[model samples]
Target: MCRRFRELAAHPTVLSRAAAAAVALRAGVWSDAAHRFLRRCAAAGNLHACYFLGMVRFYCLGSRASGVALLARAAAGGHAAALYALAVVRFNGSGGGKADKDPHAGVALCARAAWLGHVPALRELGHCLQDGNGARRDAAAGRHLLLHAAARELAAVSSARRRGRAGEDDDGAAASRFMVEWWALTSAEKPATAAGEGGSCGAGEEDAEELRLCSHARCGRRETRRHEFRRCSVCGSANYCSRACQALDWKRAHRGQCGAARWLAAGNAY
Candidate 1:
C-alpha cells in the first residue's frame, strides 16, 4: 500500500499528488521520497500539498519558520483549515518565533477562518466575542455564536458516536458542558417587553430593565420588556430575537470583530 501510494503521489496530476500526500501524511510515513514529492507538489501550487508539507515541516522536521510560511501561502489561497491552524499557532504562541505570540493577530486570523466556514474557528471566535478579548463586549452576539457552534458540535458528536469513533464521548461531554455554560449565562436575564411599553410603566422602572434593540445593523427591531430576546453569554452587549437574525448579524459583521471581544473577555489584550 505504501509503495502504491508513493507511485500515485508522484503522478503529474495535481489531484493525484494531493491525495497521495494526504494519505502518506495520515499514515505517518515521512520518507525522503514522500517529502520530495510534497515539496514539488506544493511548489506547483497545490494548496493541499502546501498545507501537508507545512505541517510535516513544522511538526516533524522542526522547521517552524518554513512551515508557517507554507501555511501562510496556503491561507492566502483561501484554505480555511490553514487559516485556522495559523490562528491556533498565533493564539498559543507556538512555532518558536516573534509571530507566535500575537494573540491579536491570532484572533483576526480565527475570525477570517470562521467566515470561511471553519467550525473550530467559529467556536473560538464565539468565545472571543463573549469576553471582548480583541474587540468590544457584545454578550448577546457572543452567546448566539457559542450556542450555534455548540449545536453544530453536538450534531457532529452524535454522528461520530453512531460510527463508534474513538473519543466521541468526550466530544459529546464537551458539547454538553458548553450548553450548560450557555444556560447559566442566560438564566439571569429578564424577559424583554415591547417598545414604548416600558416607558408607560413610568420613568423609575425604566432604569430596572432597559429596553434594547436588535444587534443586527440592518434589522434594528426594538425590544421591549415583554419580549423574550436572546442575550449574548459573555458581555451581554447585544440582543437577538431569533436565530436567523443572529446568524445574519454574524455573517454581515459580527464575525470580523468577534476575536477581539473574546480576547478582552479572557483578560488578555494584544
Candidate 2:
C-alpha cells in the first residue's frame, strides 16, 4: 500500500475511508495497508466513494460532521443508508437543520428518503401516511408499507445479532438490534389515528387543541395539538385527548390493538 493510505488511517474523522478499510479487511479486497487508500478515495468525495464512506461512518466508523451532513451527502447521491440515516436524524432532531424537529417536515423528509429506497425511512413514511402528516391518512398504504418495513427490520435485526461476537464491541449490531426491535414493535401497532378516530375530525378548527403526548404506553391527557400519540399497545389506534381519558377508556380497547399497535408506532406496521 502507498504511504498516503497509511497517513489517512491516522486522520481523526476519516469515516468513509475507515469504512472502506473495514470492508476491504473483511472481504479480502486488499491487504490492511491498502484500507487507508480506500478511505482516501472516499474522502476525496467521489460519488461512490462518498456513498460508501457515508455508510461506513454511520454503520461503523464515527466522524465529526454532526452525522447530518453524512446522511445528506449519501441521500443526495442516492445511497440508501444515507436516506435512512437522514430520516433518523430528522426524526430525532439531530441533523438536517431545525426542520428535523418538525414532525410534518420530518414526515416529508422520511417519505423522500423512503422513495429513494431506505427501509427505516419507508417505515417512518408509513407512519406519516397513517397520521396524515403532510399527506392524507391512507390506512391501506400505511399497513402495507409497515408490513414491508417490519419484515426488513426483523431481518436486519437478526443479521445484526448474528454479527456479534463474544469479545467484540458491537455498537453497529446493537444499533441494528435496537432498530429491529423498534420497527418490530412499531410494525405491530395500529394506524396513527385509530384511537382518536373522531377526536380531531371537526373537533373544530381553532377550539380543538391537540396536546399531551406520551410513549411507552403511559396514560395521559390532551390539551393542545403538539404531536400525535404513539399508538395503543393492543390496538393500532392512537388515542390522544388526555392521560385520564386514555386510561379511562383504552385499557380494554388496547387489548384489541396490542397485536398491531406497537409496530405501528415504530412506523414499521405501515
Candidate 3:
C-alpha cells in the first residue's frame, strides 16, 4: 500500500488523488501510515503535501520547528496559501515567545501573497496599513485595498452562484475562509495604543464598549469619541471605524455571528 501510494504521488496527474487517499486512510485505521505517506510526498517537493503535513505537524503533533520549516519551503515555492499561513504564524508569533512576533516580516509575506492576488492577504495588508500594526499607517491606501478585496469577494460569490457550486478552490474562497478563522483566533487580543492613550475598556461596561477596538482583526483602531465608529447593521454589537473595515469584517467574522438567532437574541434583550 505504501509503495502504491508513493507511485501515485510521484505521478503529477494523480498527486491529488494520492493525497485524498492518504487523507481517507488517516480518517480510518491507517492514521500513522497516512502521515508517513504525506511526509514522503512533502519531502518529494509536493507543495500541497508540504502545506497539509506542516499544518498538521504544527498544530496537532506539536512539531512546530519542523512544521514551520516545511511551510517555509512551500512558501518559497510560490504557494499562496503557504505564504499566507506563514504570515499568520509570524504575525501571531506562533511557536515562539512574544518577542518572536515579527509583524513587519509578516506584513512582507502578506505583500507577496497579495501580489499573487490572495484576497485575505490583501485585506490583511490593508488592515495593517490602516492600523500601522506592521507598516506605516496609510488610511487612504488601506481603504482602497479593502475596497478592492471586497469587490473581489463579491465577484467570487457571484461566480460561485452562477456555477451552482461553492467554488471552494477559488482564490477568494480560501482567503475568505482563512480570514474568518484568523479573526476567531486573534479577536480576544486588545488593540494596541500609543503612549498616554490609556487602557482598553473593562468588561461589563456596556456604555464604554463603543470605545473598544475595531471589529476587524487586522484593524486595531479604537473609537476616539462617543459613537465615533458605526455598529453592524444586523448584530449591532460589532463596531467599525469605516465602511471598508465594516465590509471586510463582515466577510471575516461578523457574517457568522450576525445570524438571525443573534439578532433575535439582541432584540429581545433590548
Task: Report every candidate's CA lDDT.
Answer: 0.58, 0.47, 0.64
Stretches off by above 4 angstroms in model 1 are 1-11, 15-17, 20-24, 96-100, 157-270
Query: Where does the lowest 10-residue lDDT sum fall in candidate 2?
Result: 199-208
Rank the candidate models, highest lDDT first.
Answer: 3, 1, 2
Error of 1 at 17 (Å): 6.5
TM-scores for all candidates: the values are 0.51, 0.41, 0.60
lDDT of 1 by residue, 5-75 (tens): 97775666754345432523422233567667678878877877776666555533446778889889989
- Per-residue alpha-carbon lDDT of candidate 3 for residues 113-165, written as tens digits (9 for 90 to 100): 99988777888888889989789999999989988987987897789889897
Most accurate candidate by lDDT: 3
Q: Which stretch of 10 consecutive residues in model 1 shows the poorest summed lDDT? A: 196-205
Q: How far out, in Å, is residue 179 in model 1?
A: 30
Q: Rank the candidates by TM-score, best first.
A: 3, 1, 2
After aligning candidate 1 to the native by TM-score, how far in Å is the CA of 223 from where it should be? 47
Query: Could you tell me the TM-score of candidate 1?
Result: 0.51
Residue 1 in model 1: lDDT: 100
